[model samples]
Target chain A: MILAPQALLSAQQQIQRDLHSCLDYFDLPHPLKDAVHHAVMLGGKRVRPALVYASAQLDGDVMSAAARRAAVAVELIHCYSLTHDDLPCMDNDELRRGQPTCHVAYGEATALLAGDILQSMAFEVLGSRMFDTADLPNPAIALRQMQLLATASSKMVCGQVLDLQAEGQSIDQSHLENIHRNKTGALIQAAIMLGATTVLPVAHPSFTHLRIFGQSLGLAFQVQDDILDITADTEVLGKTAGKDIQVQKSTYPALLGLDAAQVYAQQLHDQALEALQQVTGNTQPLQDVTQFLLHRQS
Target chain B: MILAPQALLSAQQQIQRDLHSCLDYFDLPHPLKDAVHHAVMLGGKRVRPALVYASAQLDGDVMSAAARRAAVAVELIHCYSLTHDDLPCMDNDELRRGQPTCHVAYGEATALLAGDILQSMAFEVLGSRMFDTADLPNPAIALRQMQLLATASSKMVCGQVLDLQAEGQSIDQSHLENIHRNKTGALIQAAIMLGATTVLPVAHPSFTHLRIFGQSLGLAFQVQDDILDITADTEVLGKTAGKDIQVQKSTYPALLGLDAAQVYAQQLHDQALEALQQVTGNTQPLQDVTQFLLHRQS
Candidate 1:
């Protein structure tokens, strides 16, 4: 169920426009405007926002305001996390997506401020639904979205803390899974839920099924990331290859053999598709995204 | 108009309890809980939280759930800012309030994650109105609160960037004011407005006067902070005394003489009280907080 190339391109363009509009509010004279633009506008896979749109693409091609917001917020959160994670005190990385990281492009102080503001802007975008007059959840949906985003963000922070602690330590597989679930899986789950929340009530039966789909897709995504660190070269990875092994970070290939990890990814991908079957909608977009995660090189 | 000792004490205690409850959500087995508790529960003036409670004390001594949430959210934002400000890349200060800074106490990575989590938790507490059934803003007030908090937080981030850029450079009074207005004053303004919005609608006339009051109070607070950096000793300041001079940062005492800065602080304080008089409420609590801000020794 590969996505039509047009669908993916549209989602990318829509997110770009929405992000540009969000930044216009901070368009006054300041270095922050440039720093934020650099941090966000630089290209990445747009996986999180893709999940948000793919999950919510059940309606017509013209996305609703609520869906637009869900799409922007998830991507913003994803962008901010990568910025913070690349700081000198964190991963100390100097490059991302094959270009200079935020701290390298901007000074370290400006980079830190840019990351901080992006986090606030994410919530600001969530609470910016002051003029919705349609059957949108109005403020209620925004509140729910904020709750979901905030909780997942919090869990991601904790997951980073756990991962930091786990480095250089001999932890079991469950411990590693715990870190990935919090650090990576929670936000993926929220992206789908936020999209679903845009069109359906929180109590809808579809949410239960989507949660399972998100969880499986999340693991599949991370397993592929771990696998790529070993098998892919530096240029295709857009980051230094073999960074996990260099830093001695525990990864799926380190835990299981590379061949076994690939099998696990396929298994998780199958599990994700199976869960999507329980959900009532045009789930082809989600299936395409699942396949993308399993097969992406960078 | 000075706040009664018991009133100030009660606000302090209430904020402490609410902050503890907020941290309880992250109470699972992780170092983050301890790092966040260390970042927040450590003693400071609790001035921001006090503003929230005082501004919302129109009806009774016991605060509403809306008031409680406002109080918590502002302080959380304030705490997060301070933590980030103390990072090695930012102010690089090693101590705060006579104790090691977040980065000094915890590792730098943990400290960074703690600050990030606190920011998200502030929004989470704001959107946690699911259990509130009272005439509180239900979710509207929370939405407004989020708007105010997120905007102020964004402004504060820009202000920090501006301040960082202004270091060791010649700047004028208006430029310094712009930095303070966004960095320090925006959040201070938000703290008062959040409290007011808890009890008053966005369209209330009192908000017009309160905004003026908040702007004046914010400037006065920063001016006084600058003055204290020059006149106070190290132990009393709980941070290094005269660090402003050390860093060559733009401050009132540096731009204007210490004597003129003191005079300016008083003038701003008087202007704040004048604006408060126009607001139709028992503004005594707000007045007391204002007086305390003007004359505080630390």
Candidate 2:
């Protein structure tokens, strides 16, 4: 059963609310806090956290506080990465999520600190009692989940470093895949796993299915993002279009052409849906999420 | 009882070995792996990790694996921060711990990635089985400990930001103190707390005492470092002396005068020893660590 459009939008809104509240707790110095607060306020799809909430729900822990906190954790990490990635030292874009990039609104140093604070705060929020009541196994399970998030964040950073290294290089598809897999795929997969892991103690057997769903969804999300980089309007995307070309970044569209990229995204989306089969819950939201990831306009 | 000199040296050497072995499992990029190997070879007193080992031993979790891994985690975080602290975007120091700093030896990009890898590896080491063997609470406790480390690391980054911001400014004592506390003191305190937190459960009563000890030790270390900036010879310190003055960044020595700075360090050292009073067990190593933090020649 596919989730109704209204229902999916509502879920996305709820995740965004929680994400906004969680980000509000961070207090950095001066205009940097304002810059970060504004950056988050501009708001992306909240897709990563939504997937977390959606997948955890499928595993029987749907909308639990633990799931929400983990969702928020993954999203904060993602936002932090975006802020840093857009800095002059890296991709150097002046806009993001449809607003001035962090460094453009704030100085480079403050922007750097803001991202660092958000990254650390994400772990703090997840480890706190906000989700402590989520019927998850003792603190150990929560700790393991947080550890996984950190691993994902680290991989993302490594990917950023590699991406920075790859600029202007005539890289092949494999290298490009490695970069995105580490950069985007790691966090996306972590977001899904973070949601699913909350149901682990009670639904231990379903992890493999959730992992498959997460892995496929993560790759599909990246492919769509690559497509957006080439196809979306700057006003609609809220960031500079043709950034892939400007930075000379190798993307699926760049390597495989836009049409082939679409086919690849569809295949990954189908794999994501097939992975949802092992679970016996309402798979509607999961279906919608897969479709939204692959087919969304911006 | 004060630990015999040989005993302290032996413990430090052992920690170096364990930390080296921890990195052995990671198949990192060449320059990164090579830079870290070079960093570990820098024969600075492993003061922070020693404090960890000493405090855990003082807390009577003697023969505990938690003590050792916690030691490794703290030191790795220390090394990671140092590697980045020396980056051109930050301190831009060309030398550290006697040899060329990470950025100087391996281009700035690799140095940054190396710092990142080391940071991730610190959490990984903490979450590994070696730290879990002593019936440590749950992954929650370990995760919380890691979170605490992250918080400190973030604070250190903030401090670095503050220090960088203060460059060329007419900073007073309070501002200097804030900079040192955030940049240097936070991690020092973390070293002590990481050691204690590992042995006791997350909610243990002793954490506060260990925190005080860490705070005092951290301040003492920073003041002593400031004192060294003026008093220690370049050859002895293995870095340029009076670089702080050269940069015009305010420091304890700059604010308090040389004699006053020495007195301030003594006060902090005593406070650290006093803070250790709440813990039961052998007190010698902890005392030595405090002394080492304050009065080490190099």
Best by DockQ: 1
B96 Cα displacement, candidate 2 (Å): 1.7
Task: Report residue B166 deviation for candidate 2 (angstroms).
Answer: 3.9
DockQ for every prediction shown: 0.74, 0.45
**Candidate 1: regions farther than 4 A off:** A1-4, A59-61, A129-137, B1-4, B129-137
lDDT of each: 0.85, 0.74
Tell me the tens digit of each residue's lDDT in model 2 across B152-253: 877886787778778888888888888888889998888777776656666666678778877888888888888888888888888878898998978887
Give per-residue lDDT, candidate 1, residue A107: 82
lDDT of 1 at A110: 83
Chain A TM-score of each candidate structure, as shown: 0.94, 0.90
B218: Cα error in model 1, Å: 0.6
- Model 2 preserves the real interface contacts to a fraction of 0.38
Give one digit per residue, the lDDT tens place, for model 1 in A108-136.
88888888989998888888752244543
Clashes of each: 0, 3
Clashing pairs in model 1?
none
Poorest lDDT segment (10 consecutive residues) of candidate 1 chain A: A129-138
Which runs of model 2 end up more than 4 angstroms from their true locations? A1-4, A59-62, A131-137, A164-172, B1-4, B30-32, B35-43, B59-63, B130-137, B168-175, B201-205
